[model samples]
Target: MTDQQRAKPLRALVYGDVDLNIIDGSAIWAQSMTQGLAAAGCEVTLLLKAPVTTDRLVAPLDGAPGVTLRRPYEEKLLSDLGPRGLTPDQAVTLMTRLDAEERFDLVVVRGRRLASIAAQFEALAGRLWTYLTDVPQNVAEMTSTAVSELTDIAVASRFLLCQTEELRCFLESAVPAACGKSVLFPPVVVVPEGVSGPGAPSERLRLVYTGKFAPRWNTLEMTELPAALDKRGVAAELHMIGDKIHRDSPEWAKRMAKALEGTPDVRWHGGKPRAEALRLSAECDIGLSWRAPEMDASLELSTKVLELGALGLPVVLNRTPMHEDLLGPDYPLFADGDVDAVADTLTLAADPGIYGEAAERCRAAAARFTLEKAAERLRGYLDLAHPTAPAGTDPQRPLKVVIAGHDLKFFTRLADHLMSLPGLEVRLDEWDGLRDHDQYRSRELAAWADVVICEWCGPNALFYSQHKRPGQRLVVRLHRFELYAEWPRKLDIDKVDAIICVSPHYASLTRELASWPADKVVTLPNWVDDRQLDRPKLPGAEFTLGMIGIAPSRKRLDRGLEVLAELRRRDPRYTLAVKSKQPWDYWWIWNRPEEREYYERVYRTVQRDPLLAGGVVFDPFGPDVATWLRRVGFMLSTSDDESFHLAPAECAASGGVPAVLSWPGADTIYSRRWLHDDTAAMADAIHGIVSEDRFDAARLAAKAEITGNYALERVCSLWTDLIVDGTVPEPVDLQGAIAA
Candidate 1:
């Protein structure tokens, strides 16, 4: 080590998908590096990338103690990749930032994009380590070659990414300077950290498979194993848990169904959550990893293996270095990847003598992979990187609230801050694919819920109709979703506890509905601090007129166009910008001539003919939404009926004047009383509101005042103390009974 470099605290930056649903050994490895490095004594920070839609904000990740986390979007990682994965350049940019932020002693990059990200870090030389989580024969050659240039470091490639070629290049390329440790291979998790005590068994002897249906590991054949075990007097069943990349085609399920035909003990149960996948993995007496033959297939280790190992279950698999490395002394190797071998393993599993030893071995290994072990390893790495530890404390106290909604991200900026509020607990019902029955026959999950908060759609109505108890509180968030959908009307207005709208105007609209009482509903605007509101706009602010929301029928795509027309009339150089790359229901709107015509006419008459503005401009999911908000000197909203208007306020918060259209039910207060004559007059008002600079600062200040009303602490406090607990406050006006 260089004397000068050694004196400074070494800092290790770890990256991975830390999402609750983000399972797999790679995630565990990164989590370990994050925690272990911190415990191992380095100044460590963990960086995570968003796996869901870029515009949507997912929930907060409860990070490792004393570690910082971030979701860095090099936009290119999204929009461009047609679901295949991240591009080389996006990966490079992501890695470059991590490397650039203070000469990191070690930069640990895991999963997916290994090429350009690694190459850029390697370009920095001696400062980072490439912890490739795949075997030599599993990942693609190009990726391995790129990662090799960075370091030999560590290859815990149990749940490998890519294919054979990348695997070889990564394993063979030698760089002792990267790391001195031998390959840890894939971490064999016996008991994953944070799993609630063990899952109590239901009536079924539930056996489950965790990975997607791939040629590399086809456990469909193992469906026969349970049948074989059942014949041997072992009553058990099989469950599959994944979106199986091939689910789009009926042929895949048909093939899987065929594989399970004669397997009596095995019934295709269904898929589950990653955490549930782990719990199911633990519950089963045995876990299966059936890999089909491919060039690099034999070299692969299954994610289910580590999950099973963590749960202390015996695994029956094809002979692979992955299984061999993880199984250790309790190795159960099957030479052929055939059903017969699987059946034989099941038969042997029925005879506890054959599988008990392996299960015990798994039990011994489980402790090493607990969250504690990873935390320790993280401490070591971080201690070496950044010798002196920074202060360890969360200045903002957290709220303990539960999240109850169907498969929504369940996490957003507002929710994140709410979740971080003091004395709040959070839990979300992320499983939303259900049938929408009659109003009374809503979702079954509603009965167990404390609060019902959702972004309503056709399917969302199921949640709304589920009869809520008088004690239950239902808060319907009125974002931009109310436009052009049957959901708003379908929502049962009677069961609500408190009506919190993102905009006061939106709250006012609730009053006009006559269906809801005015006192029960209040305004709670989406707010951001001035510091976050004032970031640099994208290049050439004047030419860019940013409209970040979509939903053609109502999102004011037309209003944006009208404002652009007015600006162009005033100045020719101005251009309008929108963050919608495709039309809502693109197959319906962007495809059909009628839908397209309706969309075009709405924009041209209201917007396009006047100013050439409004189309899809993918949002740069950056530090703050205000960054994009500031791009336009103006923002506009022209919707027919809005429970609450969010984008306009965010625009105002971003230091821009938000000029809005006052339609029939724009917000309950805005009727003929709040507006002029007709649509033409509304359009004229929008033009005047945006074209003049006089309204800018004052409107932004007004926005700041409104958002402060919906501050995380206030919202969370209401939910925790009043809403969930049903602590209805003594109202000044008792005439209006609250409904969910």
Candidate 2:
């Protein structure tokens, strides 16, 4: 894991359970990840689990640089070991032999049983990156035996590649061993280049669905969408692509066969190569991904939605939380599994205005998961994990570190960064909530850690302080919320080594409240991964202003509307995109009379005001902010008060200018150039920049400020220095210098 070793391309071994010849989700995932790893500077060896009959799937990777396709079905030793699909034990034995010879830098295994078996081998434990999507998705399905097995696998693997944050949180909560080790490795969409279509939808709607047909997939019911659309006076055509059909029951098989018997409106292309299917999709009007409600409960996201989005086609999918997160709630085509709902959604999508908006949403969402971005993400993980060590150099046993917190969403990237550094073994103890933690697991991880970092000054801090072990380091990061709470008073300050605050203003407040010495309370601002956030802005983004998180009434939603109204009055093209959870969605906040009245007033203002009526768009809350920011040119921070507001910095990193309202202590964290005295000034600044044609220069300057002041690499190194060497980093100055 040294710089010397990293200079050469990493050797990666990828093995999955699916048959590559079959065009299915698992097989597609296997191929995409292999290519993604190769693109990330890895010499990849993709091993086939099932016997190979067709070269259709492996053909693309056969002659690709830094990639080798291996077929056990063709090899002498593998053929002698098995005739058909390789068994779990046999696969492990094969991997063991390969490791002995090839000595792979990374091993990515897909199946659960195979990963569990591979985790038992001491030789391969440190390099294994296990990806298990078939695990029990819910708490009800997570039996004790299941948890125990997953815990063992989590302990052995260097990383657990989770497809979604929901899945990662669920796994970390259910199986405590997996907390800090999991990373989000979503599906990689390789959008075909030079593929173009009409900018607008055709008069006759063209609908398409690709991939295998199964009962759960509701592909059979999809055949009825055309008739439903026809009854609504909408001319429509449904194109079904894929050769595989559900044949477990004779009745089902016969029904599907009849459905595929082509009609004028219903056409079955059977199966085409992945590339051809996408090209066909680009030419269509809408993509159908609606499935049964049972699938809604699953943690996995449909790659079809993203694939369709990549083609700039509006997708009509189930209105699940995950879907809403990907495309905003106002995406216009969300439907239930019923045919009528889907048909109605299609009818709405047929509208020229709605179609254009949905297509743009799809394109924006898909941009975040592109193959190039996937490679960059993988390379970042590798760089963090092997910062400075050589390939075979024997170093002291890696530092065992555990980060305990209820919500580590803000801190997980830091944890991942820490895990990537050489000579650090990281694990997480995920708490159930703010006041709830798994005491047993917390105790276990605390005992094993050389250093423990509690993300929030919550119950975990109190427990860890009371149970501090001799010679073990303990640090806690105190956000603004805990300063007002009783958690700090209950904490044993003597046992805690240091308290981290995000800003000097908060640090001064913490030291005053806790009556702690200056040395004990240090300021380390939140970090933004500039590499991940830096992306191209969308067309006409200069006219689009974005505000993230507008709940609790005090965030000054009214002020944001005022700014938008002023901007739109001057230029009708300007629109304000509010990306946040609706106030009503937060039960605790909505129950308050003042909060309800404030939001109601804001709603009234939006409806009655002509300038703001069609100009304000409320987007659903999701974790895809990096891509979502692409359409936001100027990020607004109009909150009445704040500690270290991170959205402005994040937007700046995304090459967008941040226009911040001058809240108290705002000057300490950000440059004065970004802060404004009021909404009027904020609007004037934004308008001035746009009119003067200095938007690009302003954005670049903002990005530079964020990069120089709060670069993730620099901030993470500071945390690493504290955690590994027990040397606290000096607080960074707002004027581009570190305080003495």
Candidate 3:
């Protein structure tokens, strides 16, 4: 979608199982999330499960523009109800009714059972953004039944909102279906204006803890903090907020009530509005979120920690990995979840030097979780889940497109990109082998599609060409291997509307072999996911050269070694990094004598040559090229021949220079500045780049060349125009530089 289209407001339905009349974390979250969603360009309709007896906490949302709050009592039948809120089933029923009255773009459901119940409804299918905060917190709790339930929820939901990275990782590991669909929806804090900084050194240091009281929350233990601090000669006052206490253990609850009633040096303010609580907390010297040992292993984060930080109060919490990441490792106030540790931390925090440092860390960290940042994150995820249609397309009826291919490694990213775009619905017809496809599924997809894109111009392309329906458009992509195969010659070229090639060189070769019209043939290069690849370079990346895919000996692995050896002769800092499958892994290539001999010689030379010894490193091949590219300063494209070697473009997108050997048509695809005559020349060019401190300049230029021509969005836009409107992008000049 374009920027102009994104400016339009999306209709959002927000529901939580918490009572707004009560002041707690979930209740406060519901209120602040409504405002956050509205601020993120959404017209939010917040459905309340409980009756609104007090507007103390709900007053902030009253008459707020683009926000509509609906209480359960608004219905005549529920107006005379008791103090309790609607049940989970009742909330789902009400939510379904409202959805039918006017369909919302997305529904944000807060509870697991409520989300599961909503998912069962046909009207709410594929529209639920399930924010599950009460899932299995540890690996031992991930039972098979629990995993099945979460997987079912993930299948029905549009997106799963995780409160922390730890929670997201745990859920995804338990339920693999939630891997790509889950997103981090951390606790958001609304920093108030003019939060007071560190107070001057006084005899007494005040510590505050807000939120409901529970044994797991260690509110009872927090009451002992003030007394323990007194033993350490650090005079302190413990101020506690909120009146609701967990009733799981009646003895613990009674002890907490008694402790709050008449504890020495402690003051209890029974539940106040969130604003008032923050106001009281601002007067304190430090915040307290120390928890029990049981909760120490929990994957969730306390919203009160950031809330306290937003109030400019340094908090003493557990030193969990998540907390250590939020506050720097050097943060001095991290306690070990015991009264003694907390008292010691409080004593250290009483010192002016330690207090100032901790206060600065809290303030800086709080800036990242502000309301504006939360809104921006929500807006981005919303765009991905529910995108606006491009200018003239109908958003209601998205075009159905099917892609049928055997090995779709190259097309998977593009297919995912298409599925995320508005005005398009994509499906893939998987094939077992090059020519072995599910004929029934292929025919079914062809009949269901408005457009069919066949990758590799194999039997799938030929089958679709012969089975073309009356108004359906057929497009086939011809890779390098397909040009030499007999499948391309057997296709009925008249039935095909467009023939896509990865490079102009391949496009020319395809045109010469096939009787397709000049206008029907087009060159669309492979897209580089620039956003994923553009990461910070590692230390000494300037001396590391990367080479990928050396199977079958045609990739010219020996030439890459030669370049590395030549460069190492000039500067011993140079090294070669190869990520490829060993030749023996491929039976067809390893069975050949010449292929074995070529690799044997290359390995022997690497061990025998002093300049290349201990310099060549082989890493296992995987799909995580983005992370691997961080240490790859220069990517070598020393292939003997290639239609479009995508490694160079990916390297360029990763802010690494491409040392490309001048293979035939290499000049047509890449800039001449990156192309070299031979291995020696390529090595010399890299040496010059390092010696003259021109690495950064070359990296920037190479990145610009790739991002300008082959970014994911740019190429996807071209594909969208082609599949949606039957508009072929302008053809490229094969004789000149193809990047232009």
TM-score of 2: 0.60
lDDT per model vs. reference: 0.49, 0.85, 0.84
Q: Model 2 clash tally?
A: 5
| lDDT minimum window of 10 residues, candidate 1 | 731-740
The residue-by-residue lDDT of candidate 3 on 452-474, one tens digit each, is: 99988999998888889999999
Between candidates 1 and 2, the one scoring higher on lDDT is 2
Best by TM-score: 3
User: How far is 269's C-alpha from truth in model 1 (Å)?
Assistant: 6.4
Clashing residue pairs found in predicted model 2: 1-389, 2-389, 2-390, 384-420, 385-420
Candidate 2 accuracy as lDDT: 0.85
- lDDT tens digits by residue: candidate 2, 1-740: 33245446778999987778777788889999999988888889988887667665677888899898777767754645555588888888888888788899889999999988998899987789999799999878999999988988998888899898678767876776785567889988886687744557898889999988988889989999899999999999998888888799889988987887855688998877778878887888899888888989879987888888888888888887777778987778888858988898888888899989989998899989999999988887777655763233224678888999999988977886776665677898988998777778888998888889998998989988888899999999998888999999988888899999988888998999988887999888889878657766767899999999998887888999999999998999999998999999999999999999999999999999999979999887866576678789998999988888888899999999999998877888888889899899999999999999999989988888888879888898788778877777776656762221
Q: What ranking emerges by TM-score with the best candidate at the front?
A: 3, 2, 1
Cα-based TM-score, every candidate: 0.41, 0.60, 0.76
lDDT of 1 at 542: 34
